[model samples]
Target: ISSHVHYSGTREDRSSRVVETIEFTTDRGQTVRANPVVSDTGTVDRSGMSVTVLHDRDRPERFIAPQNGHGISARVPVMRIGFGLLFLVVIGIIVNGGRMILGQLPFF
Candidate 1:
């Protein structure tokens, strides 16, 4: 197996994405090469990285790479909490502004 960085986008905002592809022989003596989907934890140097794959018995081409068993990235959870707090703040401001507008009406 060989690994390389896959760069995407224009020169101003280029992003470095990493992907891993494996070459293996099936039980029936067929050679197969495919790219495997892995988690995104930022730029990864998969160069010379060795991994073990488990192939499907029914379909030899199908395979899976065992995960490291770690949970989601730290940035994901932090962003979720940040967005939630921001949403609450916006809602509170909208409600308060509406009440203030209503109090200034002639009906009051």
Candidate 2:
């Protein structure tokens, strides 16, 4: 496991510290590498940080953890057939009922 710490001071003399790099062993007995970064926010005592992960089989890029703790893999197309079938069923019902009821009403 390897790690690095850095300190950066802004022009206003306010200092900020950031820690990066993490190495650990996975359940499969494989080595994993990651870099965690911390940055200062506009508010005092508040900062944002993220980790960049490097995978053996995938591309290396920075990834921010989801706010809700749920990670998304990829995007999928929205299924339209279900909605289309629902719309057709409603239209068929409305048309059939309209004809039956209108036929009994006197048009004059």
TM-score (C-alpha) between model 2 and the true structure = 0.28
| Local accuracy of candidate 1 as per-residue lDDT tens digits, 2-52 | 667878999999988666677877777877788654444355555565556
- What are the TM-scores, per candidate, against the unseen true structure? 0.51, 0.28
Q: Residue 63 CA error for candidate 1 (Å)?
A: 3.2
Give me the candidate number with maximum TM-score: 1
The top-ranked prediction according to lDDT is 1
Residues 1-108, candidate 2: write the lDDT tens digits: 233445567777866444434454544566655542322211222123333333333323343222223443232223466677889999999999999999989992
